[model samples]
Target: MTRPHGRFQQAFAKALFSSTEALDPAMRELATQPAFAVYRNTVMKACIDALEANFPAVARLVGSEWFRAAAALYVSAEAPRDGRLLHYGSGFAEFLRGFEPAAELIYLPGVARLDTLWLEAHAAQDASAADAAWVARRTPEQLAALSLRPHPAARWAWFDDQPVFSIWERNRAQGEVTDELAWQGEGALLTRPYDTVTWQGLTQASCVFLDACAGGATLQQAAERALAVDVKADLAAIFAGLLSAGAFTAPSSSPASNERTP
Candidate 1:
């Protein structure tokens, strides 16, 4: 026979979590237990509140009312599995993809992804600056042979004609219409040291070039890859932009790298 405390605990958990409710007494407790009722409501509220606060951009994109509604359903189905609150909604974009009620908001998932990206970049470890002297140290040939390691804060995104940035800017705008389809394909380079997140529309060539560099291509090789695709593309402009933006760090060491550095 179960003690009164044990029975109450079972009922309390059921009352608190939707999944556990069917596992134990429910209706009887709802009618009879005042403390359990209060506890259950408080826990549920906390979950919804945390989700809303952590993913404010997501809430704004979908609207507070709709996001709150979805949040409640999501929380009930997926009790937080970890202690880290910021990571709670990491999988939410995928959840939004299949969420029936959110089907009308086609780009909601991508927006959610960008929000997640922002949070991740914001949490990345502090890094040293990509000083000009670092690049200047290289000899001409070494500069040409240089390979850059991306910062921990780097975020590379690919979108398919999604107006992810437009919506974000409009919501942040003093007065502007951030229609989703108004913008074309976009990509972003997220950095944390300066605490800046800049989204820029990328040409196909630029994406391929940066991607190769990210994959450890040396400067000469990456530029060759970019030019192969678009013969007239300005490799110098790409290097200048990447360098100005502090897009990466120097390679460890190589003799080929020595020819360009002092």
Candidate 2:
């Protein structure tokens, strides 16, 4: 059952977003007050500011003025569900997909998604990353049989037709896109190995390998999946790179029996 205070709180929240004329008699009077307007504006500004902070790459790609305007529209449609603003704007990427103004910038949504992944990786739970030494300790047969768990702080995605990772990385590092940049598909991987979040561009094969690993595939099976995507994929180099980036968690006591070789 809805408690009296809970109902009042919900009504007050709705009134803050709605026009004064839309509120009940009591709320309408309160909403018309100067303080109410100030509070509403402040709340909206805070949400917009949070989004700008969260998706800095997107904001940098588009100028601040444009980003803020778009963010304001998003804020009006979706309020923060979590008290912590760090987790806000989970839907901003999706909003960009359908946003008419951003239609011309085909890569905007991908950049926004990467920014969100970075935040999520940064906020993920602490875990010991599987280091190269850990892998070296296992024999080839043992490693092939083992199913590696992805680190809690790891996030990755592959973009089909846009150099999304390149664009995002440049803007994220406050660098300009050079004329030499190739317009091709790219993948991105984000991992918080230690204190700071780190990101690197990935190949489609690598992304597919990670996807297979996340789905409980053994090392050999994941390699096969990656090879299926790119016949010439360098499995050894890709595996080493992922290890260096701390993408996988420390191995469990034993291999998962449910996983099978193909």
Candidate 3:
């Protein structure tokens, strides 16, 4: 039932994915076998390299050989849809979740997700850091109604059941993975303030607070939400920390758009 072009495409795709597979019969006479093999190898290498670049922590957790094998399978199963390799591995975290061989590492998917967030933050559109002095100028009433604008390059808290942020930090420092520490749920906020992507771990209350702010809630509402998360939450410290980190842009009349203050 296959049309002529469709049949040729299916065979060509098969040949493209594997060097050992013969070229489509129609094209076999058009190109040399050696040339096809070289092309296949080059394509596979590029895909593996892209995976490695995006998930260096995953590669470090599993040795290069294991990572390479997994990458190969991933590339074959989930080839890039577009020419942009920068966005190539968006589904890799999900891929890792179903990857049977990685079943032992319950944290791998979280790590991959964090890695993707880091990439996104690094590539996000540039925005000026919010001026902390603006807070001093606002009346208490104005402040209550004022919603904080999040930096374009800032990503709100990402919570995971695994201690993904701790693992990522330790791995980045090239520290030894130890069994001595107890792992628990952790959260991360990724931001690119200057040239480097930075992240900080957050508690459940803090994560709730930031998520609320990112959704366009006023500061008072964000604090109320945080208190709902934990009655003893310290709103002042969280506000100060976010301000110091430049997680937010200038205060705006509307949360959806940034407005410059005099």
Candidate 4:
């Protein structure tokens, strides 16, 4: 049997997420004041506020009322497991996928996922980017044998149906949202080169190359993977882009303790 305190806490949690009128009779009697409703409203508001901060693009696209309604349902169904609200709603994208109201918005889940990743990358530990100059000086054999380390904040996502990167950028940009775009599959790479997190749309070859590097493959291996994905991919341009974007960390100076391949 559950202890009284345990049962009370469970009931209180349920009531917190449920309607005010649904409170247990004992709890209701204990809080015989209109202030109780204020408390409930405050809790709900805090949840909504956190979701708003974490998913600004989604909120902007969905409009306030719709977002609030969806957020309310999400909060009731999936309360934060921890007090760290920054990382709250980790599963919100998945939640939106099954949400009846958002069912028609096929691009929503991908956008939400990208937003979540942005938050995560923003909070990740900082590290210096691999020195492009130093790598450029390496001999062909040396470069082929060396493996680039993944940056602490490096992240990428592939969208099969929507131009998620474009949509996210448009919504985040200043001024009115642009509706004139040819929706198509897109991939995005995110990294924190400096203070701010940045994202860029990627080609399939770029995605494959980065995926290979992130999996600890050598430069030669990653290049081969990229070529396998797209024989015509501009390997030089991809390499330059990755270098300029600071998507990798110097193997020797990696903050993580992972082994640096020879």
Which candidate has the highest TM-score of all?
Answer: 2
**Whole-model lDDT per candidate:** 0.69, 0.91, 0.78, 0.85
* Residue 242 shift from truth in candidate 1, angstroms: 3.1
- Candidate 1 lDDT over 1-262, as tens digits, reads 9999998765555556664335545455463577756777788788888788767777877788999899888887777766677777877888899999889877788777777877787777655435556676778798778777666676656676776655554543325554445657665555554567554444556666788888988878888888887788887777666656655553445333344334
Worst window of 10 by summed lDDT in candidate 2? 253-262
Model 3 vs. true fold: TM:
0.83
Candidate 4 Cα misplacement greater than 4 A, ranges: 1-14, 18-33, 177-179, 253-262
lDDT of 3 by residue, 1-262 (tens): 9999998766766666643436555566533567876877898899899989888888888978999999999898787776878777999999999999999998888888888888888888776676667675678887777788777888754544677888877775577667654567887888886678888877777888878888999988988999997899888888777777768875444332363333
Tens digit of lDDT per residue, candidate 2, span 1-262? 9999999998898886676777899889888889989999999899999999999999998999999999999997888889899999999999999999999999999999999999999999887788677678889999899888889999999999899998899899996556676889999999997899999999999999999999999999999999999999999999999999999987655342123232
Worst 10-residue lDDT window, candidate 3: 253-262
For model 1, name the residue pairs that clash: 138-260, 138-261, 139-260, 139-261, 140-260, 141-260, 142-260
For residue 250, model 2's alpha carbon misses the true position, in angstroms, by: 0.5
RMSD of 2: 4.6
lDDT for position 135 in model 3: 76
Q: Give the candidate number with the greatest lDDT.
A: 2
* Pairs with backbone N, CA or C atoms under 3 Å apart (clashes), candidate 3: none
- By TM-score, how accurate is candidate 1? 0.74
